[model samples]
Target chain A: MSPILTIIVILVGLYGLATSKNIIKSVFCVTIIESGLILLFLNLGNLEGGSIPILSGLVENIVDPIPQALMITTIVIGSTITALALMLCIKIFHHFGSIEWKEVLGREE
Target chain B: MNDFLAQIPIFLVFIPVVFSIIIYLFKAKWTTYLSFVSQVLLLIAFFAYLSFWRLHPGDHLLVFGGWSERIGISFFHDGLSLTFSFLAIFIFSVILMYLFKFRRKDHKFFFFFLFLEGIFLGMIQTNDLFNMFVFLELTTVLVTVLISYQKSGPSFQAGIYYLLLNTVGALFFLIGIVFLYNVFGTINIRVLQELIGTQGDRTVVKFAYVIMMSGISVKAALFPLFTWLPKAHGVAQSGISALLSGLVVKGALYVLIRMERFLFVEAGFHMNELFFWIGVVTAIVGVTFAISQKDMKQILAYHTVSQVGIMMMGISQIGLTPFYGGVLHIINHALFKSLLFLGAGILIKHYQTKKVYEIKGALKTFPIVAVMLIIAMLSISGAPLFNGFVSKSMIKYAVKGNFIKEALFFLINLGTVTSFIKFSSVLFGPKAILVKEKNPLQIISIIVLGLSCLGIGLFYQVIASSIFGITISTNLWEISHFLDYGLFLVIGFLFYRFVVKKDYLPFQKIRHFKLTFESANYMFVVYLLVVLGVVFL
Candidate 1:
């Protein structure tokens, strides 16, 4: 059920990416896609009533730490790419004085 | 030497990252010298390793962080990786040498330059699926940075579009990786291959295959997903354009090929036929668009799309010779295409214009560069006694006895020849005013590339056998072959004169068609779903 919801979130993100008029919204859409993917990945590693993944002591069960670690890297990459893209978006706005995709394309060189 | 051979894979990646940091920390003046020295060392390492591998002929796997191969990250170096690394390192050195003179005092440029090289090296070396994803993402970011470093109007737009599309595509890749891990409990490619080999087909595996392949197809610039390529390659500086078209885009395709080896066990698969038809369509569409373009850079950019199609067609076939031909074409295309882009860069700078019609008398004004461009153009168009002809004929030989495939190949060649004819017309008119003197470094770099093209054409068999362990029949002197080539040229010339010269209705329609980012994304999603449907249903 939660996995289906994550896919729904991804679908919504894709829709936003396709239809968003504003560039910033599209960047946000990209982040949303990343978030949904990360959620899906984390969901795969989850165990019901699992304890924290640590080396303290042997427990009955624990969440898989691999996906968690991988998600951390994925989150870092997503945030850094988003930040850089938004910086470029600001530069684009300054250059063309518009943030809408259609208007930005319409502006002549 | 044996111990050192084992360590080459690590040094291949490590030297570049270390030197990138070193160059970044030092003064701007030291950046060039440091980069130069590092590239030379990298080149020496690559050649020594390649020569050792040639003698040894075995796979070398380096386990990262001192872990076992079953669970730890591992970098696999084989003939395939070595071939691409050789191409990448050689092109990097040549471009760095050329840019040495034209480089401004920007330390960030050098930093990204070496960093990009390291990422590419690591990408080619790694056998871990998740590690490949990480490298792919890093490359996406670095390329975005390099493309937008100028911060111009078009560059910024191109950069953002590139970021959005690639990020979306890569996220899909991650999704595939997650699915694979969930099903198989491992992310290493070799282990997954062994598991799938024994376990046979499953619903989740096929789903993961289609999703990951769709994502990789975006990077490979396969037919519908190639919208961002032209904007990014055509907008940037020539050096970046050369790198993007020559190496960066091919990196994705390389990963696709690597994955195909492991995931899709041979026979009864749909992707083969799908890739073939896509290649045929991409060839026709790419050239049709190239002919409609008025800008020089845009023409070259579209032509890159077309050549990729040709390479795709070659590799898509089932036979060993065709596969060798395709691999060989990758290297051959890299050489001549980068040479053409760099040469076009020089012309654009000298004329202060990118318009094809405005540029005049390159042959008369810049005779040396003109000759060099002619060599590249000839090689690209597969003219006799050039590098293009050899690999093209190998591909032709590969698809022999299939009249439809042969005819399609001929049509692609004709399109290629006709477009380059239009491109080469700049060589024959009144001289442009106030041409700049040629830079010696640029000249040397181009000359080296040009000579390699000629040398490869002359000694193709030797190079082919040495690199790919296959010997091609170099029967260029046969009268029948000459007649066929002559027919191709005559028809190509006539087609250009009557059809493309007049700019007919269909051609005009192609010119007016533009795929916006929204439609492009939509196309990607549509294709992804379609491929999934085909694979699963």
Candidate 2:
């Protein structure tokens, strides 16, 4: 599909994030959004008949390896972010003894 | 000399990376020694950059891989890049020196700080766009954990928010990079510059500029995208706040500058107007929020928004294209801002309270800290002979090309002065004994920065023209100095009365901060998808 579709995915994901009360659910939505973007990037570099970007000595055309390389970096970075976010989630739960964003966000402080 | 300087610059970037990995095996004491050794080496590298600037003026160096430019990784160091890298490494070295005290019980913070410094240095020096992305991600991962280093509710929530915000911004950045790589066939900055120079302006080029700047503006925390900045900054530890506010946002600004010059040429100049206007709005609204803040660091956090406005305004105004003004202020802000935050860290460590009322009488308790803080206050407020004035005035005159822009920015300056005036009062007026100073290292750092601020103002022209490689005209110096001294006197009085004693709301620790893994995972995927689609389309 078009890039607009991916943007729509982001908007929906954000909508879920703003409205969702569970920290874990919000985190999951963020990852889903990230996955969609990665898929889009992979699609961007796609050739009509291309398989994965691994070494194939065939004469047929292959996808660009740069974006693929970048994707791995992005994925690793994304996972690290996910891990850190979860760690923070655990910390928040420990301090407040609750996962509901509304109850915590309600205070003016 | 030229050959050595150029080769050493590349080695500087690699040495730290190598050392960082090597130290991972036995990090407790080794990391501390490794960071110290690397930081000293980094400082020497900065000095080499200085010599190269003196030796070769207004020239950009592209360190290509042994292969041709397009296919190889290149290190692009320009007048702009060199200046930023120097400032970053200088501050980083100082931070590393102070890390000794912090290393007493924790290797985690120490290791992370060095890695953070190394990543920023690598990001600044690398001309390859893909390499930039790698360093950027490295920075993000390190900083996310830094935000949550202490692991409290507020820290955790802030960490989560920062991750969400930065990830989205980074994805936008990747999208921009993908678009550029598609259109130009190379992501190396020097190569891209040549390509854009040949074609000049096109729909694709303009589209790329907008997309890329959108991503950068997010990281710079400019205007609408700045919502996460204060929360993340306030929630972080004092040192982390300093680094984030003083340097990390600067990474984004540096990239935007490089992109503007290389990709859009003057096509991106229009963003200056937007940047200038939004800067004023951000300054006014941000400081308005600051005046309401009672939480000490949160107030400083909001002040970051205001300071960012001033720095951007320096660059956006006409006849200020070299943007020396913003660069200078960036250095000034990093010095004083970091100093203030570190001092605040000392207080919190002692008193265990961040509230304004609760943090009273710091002057009596920590006399040395009080003195250091006053110096920072003077520097931040653009007082005479301090660094803040030198660059701020350059911006003030630079933005005065028209009546409306002039008026808006003047009001911004007034608001900035007023907000700082308020902070200075709380800093010295409080007589309460909080934390006794345990770390002499932190205080020494504050003093070092304070001196640097004064030195920057005294040698403004030399810094702008000589070290920074900007060709400074006598007229710009004359006008800027006059304005600098003018704003100083007026604002100095404003600080002493009608502003300092005014009561304001302090933002305490955010309560019951929320975290839902499901939502976070979902948001992450969607944003990453946006990056992908942009590349594909």
Candidate 3:
């Protein structure tokens, strides 16, 4: 919920993305970074003590709905890319018989 | 008629989408014909809209869903967006004409091609930042599909690398957008530009700019983030390679220009120096790699990197003249580079090989294509009386009286000439064994592009004025300009014969030096950190 926590999540994602050898882990790391970004956007729009965006008679402090709408689009885009990436990894695996980043290029002529 | 013409931007974007769906669902063999008809219609719409813009000379906004500006998507047209979209349509139509008769029959090719056209049309038209991001993602996915359409060879690997890196880059872009939105509540570009101007320079805003620029640099294939480009452009289908090198990367550069010239114009000078150095480094490294490459496609691929650097260098200068030069070069580079790539494709297909050494005597076997190749080669190398000369000279004239910068620019030109000499070697030597008959449509495509090169050069003033709405004197008739080009050519020829020809040890080492995907990913992190430091420190 805190902005600092989201930054840490992003840093962790970057670390995994940088160090990981497996192609699948790279995709996972991308998803993690996307999640962190979505979380940050959601946090930015939060009212300290707010009700749902849906208008009710009791609605007093409502959260900004723009970022939430933006995150939904971001989530869809991120997931599509992730899905395509994993599919490509499978194709790479089929070609190289290994999905480790170094192994694929090493085994190729 | 006037009222109907007002919605031309909508027609340009949606027609392709509708046609692509039609092509896909029908599975008809005449899908290419369908695509070509739709593109022609779009081109007509563009011409009508462009004439309207010329008469009005202002932004024409098209609001979607009838919502307010702060909440809804909008498409606006001015000169720049119109020119870019026109370029996309022009190039795509040319490609469609060539591919219709020459390429192998595949239904999906038409689908992807049309889809990409529509996406590019939308990319230039949209004014919303989030909408730009969405189109960018769609383009990334579509380009990846087109690149890996062959589904084998190095392209598969190239596709994966391109996909992964670009996805990461897009995420960084999204992060930048998030920061921007938190600071300023709307995602509209014009609104952001006004806010940035009013608020002065904030550290968070500067940081956001750096983050976004880094992300875009990856897409533009600038310096450190360009590892995936050569692989994808060199190994993919020739049409795909030509499209990627020629127009797709320019999308990112367009965003870069908009941001620098509009959003962050106040602090632009601080960032300009950084851009200048990066452009110089990218240019030098690109040409160095190009000089060592034995494969024709790889050589062209590397040259794209160098040429992009040159464009960046042009824009980094503070003057409007140099910036105009940079914009013109984007158009020139797309025309000549795609012409070269497509011409090379014909040769590669005929010979059934990509190695330059394996093929010989192009001038003898394919006289027309070889002539086209020569025109393209000269234009790219900035020979006098070519399209490249006009823009390159403008850039040079912009940085006049600065000796070190002038010399650096000269060195880049020298490198360009030297590498192109090596590339053009296949045109000479004895006649090679002919493999098969060449396609008539391929020759037509080459000639059309070749004529455009000459036409641009001959009508440089008129073309520049019309497209960019700027006028300047071009003294190509002067003797000194001739001598400069002549001297550069002589030096370049000698360099190629003596140094590049010998397979020198350093060249060999650099040629064999591979940047793996993991290391390239590491470089992205380093690039981001360095950019952050440069912006905030």
Candidate 4:
């Protein structure tokens, strides 16, 4: 059920990405999709009644730690990509004087 | 010595990275010299290790922290990975020499460039799926930085488009990994391969394969996803363009080959027929677009797409000969295509124009560049006694009996010949104003590549047998082969004279055709859906 929900969220992001006119919006949409993916991965690693991954007294049904570890790395990587994309966006705006995809990319060299 | 040989993979990946950081921190005047020395030393070490490994013949896997292979991140040194790593280092060294001769003083560019090499080497050698994902993402970032290094508007545009599109594609790959990890509880490819062979839901595996391949198709620039390649490769500096076109895309193809071998083929899935048809379409579409382009780099960029299609065709064949033929073509294409791009770079710089029609009399103004370009052209167009002829004939020999496939091959080759005929016009016209050749380093790099093309063509049998251990049965020197090539040249000349030279309405329309970012994403989605439908239904 959670997987389906996260997938729907991902699709929403995809839809926004396909229709977004502004470059910033596209970047946000990608972030949305990435957030959804992270959620989906975490949910996949969850147990029915899992406790926090920290090993307390009983250690019953500790959620799988690998997905959490992987997602942390993914988050770092994804943020770096987001920062890079936005930086490129700034550069694009500085050069073309508009951040609209049509206005920026459509100009003839 | 044996231990050192085993650790070559680690060194191959980290050496560039370590050098890049040191160069970045130091920012000394001798950074270029230092980088050059490092590359040369790395090449020497690689050759020494290669010889030693060949003599000793032992497993070269490096599991980190002394952990079991299934649990730890690992690097596998096999024939395929080692070959590609060698290519990465070799091409990076050539570009280094080219830059050193050009006297580029930017420490930042060197930093990113060397870092990119490290990431690329890591991508090629990694055996873990998650590890590969990390390397791939890092590569995309590095390539984006390199593409936008010029800081021009078009460069930024191309960089952003490439970054966003490829990130989305990488996300798809990640999702595929999520599904696999969910099912198998492991992300190690070797472990997954074994487990998948024994048991797994067939539908899930099929879906995973489709998703993973869709992501790879973007990287490989197959069919609809190739829109970014020309924009990116066309806008960059010549060395970057050559590296991007020559080796970077091949990394994706290498991954595809690995995935197909370990996962799809291992688990009772055979999509060779599907890939063959896709290859045919990619070839036809790529050629149609290439033939209409007037810009020299754009024309060469589109040909990379078409040649990749041809490579896919050879790889998708069932026979072993065609498979290695495709592999060999990858190396051959790298040689000639880099030579062509580097040559085009020189011409573009000296002639001060990118349009083929506007730039004339290269033969007179720059004799060396012209000669090198001719060799590259011959190699690309499958002229006899050139490298392109050898692999192309191998692919042709595989499809010899089937009339329709044969016709498709013939059509693709004809397209290549015709477009090159159009390209060759720049070599001949009235001699333009004489421009003195200033940089001998540029000449040296291109000459090295050009002679390599010739040498590879001349000694293909020895190289093929020694490197790949595959004996070629196709008689390369057959009279019929030369006759066929001559026939192609003649017909291609006629076609170019009558149709392409005139620049018909259809050609103009094709030249003007452009895909917006939104539409490109839509096409990616449509491509994914289509592949999914084809695979499942």
lDDT of 2 by residue, A4-102 (tens): 677677567666765666777777766766776676666677677766666657645767887777788778877877887787777777777777765
TM-score of candidate 2 against the unseen true structure: 0.86
Of the two candidates 2 and 4, the one with more favorable TM-score, higher being better, is 4
Stretches off by above 4 angstroms in model 1 are: A55-57, B1-4, B51-59, B266-270
Runs off by more than 4 Å, candidate 3: A55-58, A107-109, B1-3, B57-59, B102-104, B266-269
Better of 1 and 2 by DockQ: 1
Model 3 lDDT per residue over A1-109, tens place: 7988998898888888888888899889989999998998899889898877876667878888889998999989988998889899889888888888888755444
Candidate 1 lDDT, B205-286, residue by residue in tens: 7888888988988888889888888888998899889899889988997888887655555323557667777778887888
For each candidate, what TM-score against the reference? 0.96, 0.86, 0.97, 0.97
Best by lDDT: 4
Best by DockQ: 4
Note the clash tally of each candidate.
0, 65, 0, 0
Question: TM-score of B chain for each model?
Answer: 0.96, 0.86, 0.97, 0.98
Question: Mind giving the per-residue lDDT tens digits that candidate 4 earns over B163-182?
Answer: 99999888888888888888
Which segments of model 2 are wrong by more than 4 Å?
A: A1-21, A50-60, A107-109, B1-5, B21-24, B27-31, B49-65, B197-201, B266-269, B427-435, B469-537
Give the higher-TM-score candidate: 1 or 3: 3
Error of model 4, residue B246, in angstroms: 0.4
* Candidate 3 structure quality by residue, lDDT tens digits, B1-537: 766777788888899989988988887676657887897798778888878877765548877888887778898877788789988998888777667765546767888888899998898889888888899899999999999898895677889889989988888888888888888888888778778755733877887888888888889899988888898899788877888998998888887887677666754436777897899889889988999988899999999999999999888778878888998899889889999999898889888889988878889988888999999999999987899988887777655898988888888899998888888887997877776674676677768888988888888989988887788676775888888888988999999999899999998898777877778778989999988888877
RMSD of each: 1.9, 4.9, 1.7, 1.7
Q: What C-alpha lDDT, on a 0 to 100 scale, does residue A31 get in candidate 3?
A: 92
